[model samples]
Target: MSLVIGLTGGIASGKSTVVELLKKKNAVVVDADWIARQVVEPGTFAYKRIVREFGTQVVGADRKLDRTQLGRLIFGDESKRRQLNRITHPWIIFYMIRDCVMSVLMGRPFIVLDVPLLFETRRLLWLCTVTVVVVCDRDQQIDRLVRRNHLSREEALQRIDSQMPLQEKAAMAHFVLDNSGSLLALEEQVENLWQQLQCIRKQRLRYYKLFGTICFGILVGIPLCRSIATHL
Candidate 1:
């Protein structure tokens, strides 16, 4: 059976970096951000829903989502953000599930679901047997977000504040990755986690086979010994 691992992190915590490295290792990486964008393409239900709810002004002349404009709108208000999430999440999860099944069908031994809001939804537990959370200090996260997204410190902090905190999510994660250090350190942690997971998958199979074989031998041996005792 294929292993489905959920990967999550707070904004700018190096979760994307981990995903990129995992791709280099040929692991199936299913990203939620990409799926969210896909489901909202010009003609999609999600697209129509947003245009209807927020108005046609959010759509660009190119017939696509005005992502920057929408981002500016939703990020400025909690209610608008919720509205956006409500419209996008159903379609995102729909394609996520379908794509996961397709990955299994395609013989992907392991599939990683990259979700930024994995902890908030709590639906990941239904499908993911294992969860890995990437984390960093609040200061580091704020710094990275500002640098990567070209936002002011306060804007970056506002974005981070919008999601579930790293501490809360990490508390329940099967594995926690610390990315507050240098690139090499982060890479080493990811590599170590990958190796540990591989070992666990193999050992779990070995344990099942070993226990089954032992149980079978005991059943057969006990019956034969009982028969011999009766004859004697």
Candidate 2:
């Protein structure tokens, strides 16, 4: 089995940078954002359900989901957001698990599940060997969002406020990466964390092997003891 790491961060956090570094180290990544888009593609089951729930206005002329328009629709509407999640989350989870299984079959040492809403959903937490959250200060996050998305300050703040707070996420995570400094600093932290995860993986493998050996001995010993008792 592979060490499955659930990776998440608030918008504009440097989670992508860590993911790229992990990729360089040969970690297999299962990205939820990519799967979310795939599940909502033109004729997918989630797509059909979305159209039925949100109507045709959310669809573009190219027969693709106008994600921007749909975002606008659910921006401040809690009920609509839940409705959309109910439609797409199941399919996303299905694809995520499939990819993880394939990675395990191929003998990946570790698997990174890049899920933006990992903490919010908490549905896939059980599958993770560890959970990591990347975070920066609120001001840094807001500034990054403003520059990256070309949004005004107020807009950036609003986007940041929409999701669960970074602090809250960090509190729940098994490990927290503080990305408020230089790229080299963040890279160093990631490397250290990777080493720690590798140690954990080895420990788990050893435990599983020892457990199997004990069970095998118990099974064999029970039959041997029964035969000896019958003869005596």
Candidate 3:
């Protein structure tokens, strides 16, 4: 059986970095962001839905959904963000599940689903055998978002604040990849997890077999004992 590993974290929490490391292992990496974008490509149902709701302002001269335009409008507005989520989240989840199932059915030992918003919508959690949450210090997350995305500190914080806290996410994760340190250190941790995961799976299978054997022994022994006692 294949293992589906759901990878998630807040924006700029080094989730992408962790995904890069995972891909180095040759695991099938299904990035939800990419799937989301795919579902919104010009002729997609999601694209049609978004355009119908948001109108032409959100579309460019190329007649495509101007993602940056929509981002500017919705990133700071709660109602708008939720509206956009309503329009696109369902389709995105559909593509994510499709790709994940395809990867697993192809006989890959593991599939890494790099879903940045795994917890945000709570749609794909059921597909995961194990969920790995990549995290960094809150300060680092804020700083990276502000610098990389060119958002103000307030904007960065609001984006971060809109989701589950990193502390809470860590506790809830089946595995946590701390990305506050150097790339080498982060990779070391991932490698360790990979090895330990293999060992844990092996142990689980062995335990299952052992349990089956013990149950069978007891089942047979009980009947034998009863028969011998009756004969005596």
In terms of TM-score, how similar is model 3 to the real structure? 0.85
TM-score of each: 0.86, 0.94, 0.85
How far off is residue 22 in model 1, in Å? 1.1
lDDT of candidate 1? Answer: 0.88
Where in model 2 is the C-alpha error above 4 Å? none
Error of 1 at 85 (Å): 1.4
- Computed on alpha carbons, the lDDT of every model, listed in order, comes to 0.88, 0.91, 0.85
- Residue 96 lDDT (model 2): 91
Candidate 2: tens digits of C-alpha lDDT, residues 1-232 = 6899999999999999999999999999999999999898988889999999999999999999998788767756778988998999989988998998899899888899999999888888888999999999888999998889887787677667778999999999999999999999999999999999999999999999999999999999999999999999
Could you tell which candidate, 1 or 2, scores higher by lDDT? Answer: 2
Clashing pairs in 1: none
**Residues 125-172 of candidate 3: C-alpha lDDT, one tens digit per residue:** 899888899889889999999999898898888788877887777787
Model 3 alpha-carbon miss at residue 42, Å: 0.8
Residues 1-232, candidate 1, lDDT per residue (tens digit)? 5778899999999999999988887889889999988999988888989999998879899989998778778887999999999989888888888889899899787789999999898765678868999999999899888888788887887789899989999998999999989989989998998898788778767887999999999999999999999999
- Superpose all Cα atoms of candidate 3 onto the true structure and report the RMSD in Å to 1 decimal: 3.9
